[model samples]
Target: MAESPFAWIDEQARARRRAGLVRTLRPRPADTPLLDLASNDYLGLARHPEITEAAARAARVWGGGATGSRLVTGSTELHAELERELAEFCGFESALVFSSGYAANLAAVTALAPHGSLIVSDAGNHASLIDGCRLARGATQVVAHADPEAVRKALGTHSGPAVVVSDTVFSVDGDAAPLTGLAGVCRESGAGLVVDDAHGLGVLGEGGRGAPHAAGLAGAADVVATVTLSKSFGSQGGAVLGPARVIEHLVNAARTFIFDTGLAPAAAGAALAALRLLRREPERAARARAVATELHTRLTAEGLEAVRPDAAVVSVRAPSPEQAVRWAADCREAGLAVGCFRPPSVPDGISRLRLTARADLTGGQIDRAVRVISEARR
Candidate 1:
């Protein structure tokens, strides 16, 4: 047998093992009992009967898949309705749905800024946004994480059309970006602002309208946002919300939007149901924020280096990547499922335990989660 060109993968795998960075998937049983904090379901709607029913009903009515690209045959009435409600709820003039939030980010970045244009991205942006910057036709400058002055300086260096991209809430540290400051800088420079509100959609603003709306930038001519339906919406897919012109431009120019199939009807239905429920019971947003704050307070009080949460995510730092892996494993062994984030995923190369706070968590659950995490730390 001849050695393949991909033989270096074996060496890479060994290196990963030595660094305790080997990744694997574990299939969870439907009814397995474990305290879960790893998933991005920041709200309880994923399991809600209404949401599930909506998904099932949508699948039954719209069929299993979207059939083809949206322009061809993928668009469903359900998708339109979802987009309409989502736009109105988020206070945007228009919204365009995609297969996932990652796709939405790519569509926004790649489409909005063309050749000779500039894209000033935050250093701590999500991978999707980073990839979008890479794929975009515009030249990209990565500014310091959450530093509005850095953003201003980046924009000042260029005189042409520019767009500023950032995550409303950074994923690794669970710290929030200075949205208001960024918006002000963009406004002053006459640059467009594009926010990926994946973490903020279900935890910020009035009933989770999102970080941009909370910052009073929603529907602003120079502002845009992308959201994930899978997070607080407890569904699947993503959407880009902005002025009508921007969305129209996406429809015509964004390859990710035009080439990718439309979001599934089931996901659209579920997200719509979740949005309506959130509208009816707006306290869910506040509840999720409270849970994150409580988790941060308790963990920090125990002498753990936990970042102060600005939304529903609370991150506790580990000494090293190996320690982070071991700590998460220990927590899982103790009947608690937690998220472990390490190098490459973390731009700062700091490993940590990432936990998402859900709106539906009860007081007892919060205490249990905190105790389990604290006990596993040391």
Candidate 2:
């Protein structure tokens, strides 16, 4: 005869159910017959033999986990090698690897935006960047999505140290940010530009250098980039790429980097293998982009409202949240796996079926996926 301490959580769950916003997890098996368009494996390297083999080799050579923080006993030869190669490949002066992309974002944002600084962030930035802005000591001003003029205005209002943050390619709509324009504005205002290329690496630029490289902003003294190894490299870690001084600053000041353990050796080795593979086969990047364009063209031709993809993600509008969930289920039933986006996930409150184009997806697979999606549309 005692009231539950978590009674409020039950009420919130009931509210979510009534609003059709309740979410649940569905674990996937190692091998499935369904065609996948839901995962972020844009380069289709997650299951590559070389990548996996490297991971296993690393685990054997360097043990399972990082024993301590990077400053303590966590740094390893593999991490150093990955950082050096990643920086060189991405055209940066230096790079620092982190345990995860979220932590990398946090480190970059918090380390760069010191106290009394101003942080101008894009309205449509990823959650990690948003959380970074929230945790940073600087004041945050969210500008319109992909708007350089708004960023300029925001920077103009501030007189001291300022940094503009955004995603290179938005994950939700798959639209690219105006990197050149944002960079120009930042230069004009003497502000630093920080971009999260989580969705751009291995899907844009020559040989998948990234959106910043594509925009000619790579290695700029005032520019910084954060990338995830999990999506494109089929590994599990994140890195911050910028000038050596900035990286050094992060090593000293970024709590996420200084206090957190170094990236696992397995992830570092896998990412290194994937990066070398990408360098050898540069066409993979172009292939992924081509697949995205093809998916968008075919989806629109089939009369579905799909956004024009700038990278490997293709988003198709859905009528409602419930309908979106049902439509995704229907696609699964048809032997296709797709992503479903709804209310809180989509800033605009529009539901969607989000499809990720992979470099390894064949034309036949594309056709089949399109057909399944078309038939499953509500």
Candidate 3:
């Protein structure tokens, strides 16, 4: 008999099961009764009537898909409009939209860090950024998490074009990067700074202008930022915001942008609508942050160890991976949905119950969520 080529997968599966790291997906229903704290809809705009109507209107007018890569036949007038508005809102000189945030990061890093250059990446950066560094032609050196001094030291050793990459707010622990410090070091070293604001787009800065803007790096010649529309915008896409020259470079050299299909029209429309709505209701940004603070305060008051959130994410430390999974299940049983983070997802190898704070959540909802989480803790 021929050898079983796929036999290793079973062994890996068994190991994962023994380690309590097995992952499974649960499809959500259209009308779920459970209160949601697992989603990234920080501003509660995903289901807003106006946003949905915009999506519908876009689909009616632009059809279902972009139909080609951006340069080929997919660059619609709507895309250009969204790009202009996004750049303006984020305080960047220009912007380019991608199919997703991951693609945007890949495009930015790989395009910016060419051969003989250096990429000083923070240890706690998102996987997308890490992958971008890996894919880029430059030499990459990862420094301590949120440590500007480490980045400075690394940049000092490289006598070439260099860029420092980090997340504005780390997703795992919900802690913010030292953006001001990092930016200062980058300026001193004559290095460009690239930040991923996936968690900061609608939860940080004045009126959610974003972390880079809040750090006064927005529209800076050497600063570039990437953001996801899926989170606060309640849509599906990503974009790179930077100087017009950088945007032009990516348009010409970024493989992801050049090769990948353009963002869907509905997502573009929905994101534009959300951006306009956010501009009108800037208070939504502060509300999301307040909700996160409240969640952290209440959880810690109940003796649950939670990292203080800088944005809308609240992470509660769990004793173990098994306990974390069981706790999340228990919370689900109690009609509250929360996120569970384990080994591979958490850089520190610590398990956690990740909770998201939505601007639309009421006081009663917050109280109930805290109670349920407390009851579910082992």
Candidate 4:
């Protein structure tokens, strides 16, 4: 009998099962009676009629896909419009859109940190940023989470071209990074700063201009930011915002941008519509933050351990992975959908129930969600 090359997969699966870390996907219906707190639609605009209509109209005009890689044939007028508006909104000198947020991060980090360069990354950065560092030709040193002093010390060790990479708001714990402190360290060391504001885009800053803008680092010569359109924009895509020269560099040198297909027209259109809507209704940003605060306050008041949310994410501590999974299931059964985070996803290896606060959620919805979470806790 021939040896099975796939036999190891079964062993790994068994180990995962024994450790209560098995993951399964559940398909959600388009219309459900459940109150959703698991999705990243912070502004609750994913299903907005205007946004959907924009998507439909774009597909009708652009014919579905982008047709090719950006440089080859994919750059359409809509994409150009999106890039311009996005840059203006975020206060960036220029911007380049990618197929996804992960791709954007990879392009920015790998392109910026070339050979002989030093990349100082925060310990709590998203996996995309970590992978970017791994793929880059530069030497990478991961510092303490949100510790500007650690970054400064690391930068001091290298005299070559350096860049500090971090997330504006950590997704796992929902705590915001000290952007001002990090920016200061980068400036003192003469290193560029790259921040992933995926979580902060539509939830932080004045009118959701973003964390970098709020930190007064927007349009700075040495600052670059990556954001996802999937979250608050209720669309599908990502972009890099920075100086025009850096944007040109990414276009020329970033493998992810050059090799990957362009963003879909529908996504670009929907994102643009969402951005315009957000501009008109800036109060949506504040409402999301308020909802998160309310959820945290109510959860903690119920004697549950929850991290104080800095954006629209609220993370509540769970006793174990199994308990966390069960708790999330219980909440779903109670007509409330929440997110469950476990071992590999959580940097600290602690399990948690992650809930998102949507701007459209009503007072009754918030009260009901908190009650369900409390009752679901083991």
Candidate 5:
């Protein structure tokens, strides 16, 4: 028999197994019995009755998917309305929706950082932002995580068009970037600042206006933000919010926007509904933050090594990748669903159990989660 052309696949699989880094999908049923601490639904609106009804209504009115790209046939009145509300709520002059948050990041980075431009990215940004920097035409220099001085130094090295990119709230450690300091450096250097607020929208600022709004940069002309509807908004899509001119430029120049199909109508509708719900029930945001603080405090008090959450994510360290996986599995067996982060996913190569705090989680549930996690530690 001829040697298989894809023999390298088996070798890589073996390597992953040896390194305790093999990953597999575990599709969840519609009605899960386990207490969820793995999802990004910070406001607990993903399955809300109002959100579901809006999704159904939009599907009935618009269909299951967007028919075409925004430039072709997919721009609907619903999309326009969502954009308007998103911009206003986030204190931006305008907003542009995309098929996913990843797409939005790619669009914002690639469109803004043209040839000869320099992109100073934070070391601990989300993968989407990292990929965006890679895809952009400009050169990217990664600075130390959460260091404003490093950003300033990087900006000093370049004289052409430059933009500073970072996550408002990092996903792995749940640490927040110094947005005010970054903005100050950008202003001093005459560079634009682009941030991904995926983890901040429903958990930070006054009534969850987001990290940028909290830092007094939301409406600034020199700043732009990308956010995911799948998170706080409890839907499936992403958007770029900024000054009217920057958004207009993205609509005209961003390849992701020009070629990719528009965001689904149902997602747009559902996100809009969730936004309205957040507006009416602003306490949900505070509750989500409180839950995170309680989880971190409880876990740490129990002698667990965990990062102090800046938003709704709590990251607990594990001794090794194998131990992290086993810990997560044990927690799952004990009726808790937690996120397990391992090598390649974590930039620092540290494995940890990631827990997401939701607004709807009760005090009893929080205590139960803490107990389960403490008992399940490897």
Candidate 6:
């Protein structure tokens, strides 16, 4: 019995290293010049001059960080304004912002599912959602990926308060869930449907209102949605949106929202600016989807096993995890930075090279990226 209680950590680390799964943070320089296809800034707004400027101004005006927990001193007019605009933009009755999309998912899943409730989750959801399910108080049934029938069957077995949780668009494969079908299944079971629209907002629907809006479930009393500002808003936060009553419940009951510091003023300001920009120039959202489609088409034509995108993400299968990692490394060497997804990021036990399509990419950039990717395959 070691007093430190950390003696086994080294063994696990060595095991992870041998498995080629040890992850480390690499500090990126401001002037690093790799062509990015890995970042989630689908709208290409993360480094936009206006967005950065707004962030700078906010930090100067409101200080460098949120001073306290949102329930205490962290809530500000900026947060309130962003919440209002986000809810209205996405057609929800109310919205509550959290520190990150991960936190938002945790809050939503835990707050909505009570001790005796049931949670029906999709197998292909993001890791955050999967973790949220694990943290939830209710018993969770992981249904098959995007199978409404599976959802129905799971709900049939449970006769309590149930919630069907899924990502609007599967992150790894970039394939969309049958939201309409899932909603119908939930409707029959008297269950609420909770969607993590991380890859949908600012990349789906008219003006990127999100998949919930596209499926006509945005303001539905039985539906709740979560979104991330880091992806399309080019900011750093997440939100949960739903009926006013649901939001009220989250405000009081969601531990993440009440205990964590409010999203920084700079992020809130930048996200607000981006949202307004998107409202004014809605084509950014459409362009992102178009880029994703074109990338998939070109990759498939070049004899790659790329998944046809449902949003701004494009995933091409690789032979193995090591090969996938090497392929991505080669791409980086070729001045093209792309994402490499391996187990357990991919729930299907398949590895992939994940490419994010930026709305701002040019024709030449697309061609170059395609060439680089094709050449890097094992």
Q: Please give each candidate's TM-score.
A: 0.99, 0.99, 0.99, 0.99, 0.99, 0.97
lDDT of predicted model 1: 0.92
Error of 1 at 37 (Å): 0.9
Q: Write the per-residue lDDT of candidate 3 for residues 109-207, one digit (tens) a residue.
A: 999999999999998889999999999999999999999999989999999999999999999989999999999999998999999999999889889
* Residue 351 C-alpha lDDT in model 3: 98
On residues 290-348, what C-alpha lDDT tens digit does candidate 1 reach at each position? Answer: 99999999999999999999999999999999999999999999888899999889999
Residue 296, candidate 5: C-alpha displacement in angstroms: 0.6
TM-score of model number 4: 0.99
Q: Which residue ranges in model 3 land beyond 4 Å of their true spot?
A: none
Window of ten residues with lowest summed lDDT in model 2: 369-378
The residue ranges of model 2 lying beyond 4 angstroms of the native Cα positions read: none
**Which lDDT tens digits does candidate 6 get at residues 198-281?**
999999988999999999998999999999999999999999999999999998998898889989999999999999999998
Model 1 alpha-carbon drift over 4 Å, by segment: none
Q: For candidate 2, what is the TM-score?
A: 0.99
Evaluate all candidate structures by whole-model CA lDDT and list the values in order: 0.92, 0.95, 0.96, 0.96, 0.95, 0.93
- Which parts of model 5 are misplaced by more than 4 Å? none
Q: By summed lDDT, which 10 consecutive residues of candidate 4 come out lowest? A: 369-378
Deviation (Å) of 302 in candidate 6? 1.2
For candidate 3, list the clashing residue pairs, or say none.
none
RMSD of each: 0.9, 0.9, 0.8, 0.7, 0.8, 1.4
Ranking by lDDT: 3, 4, 5, 2, 6, 1
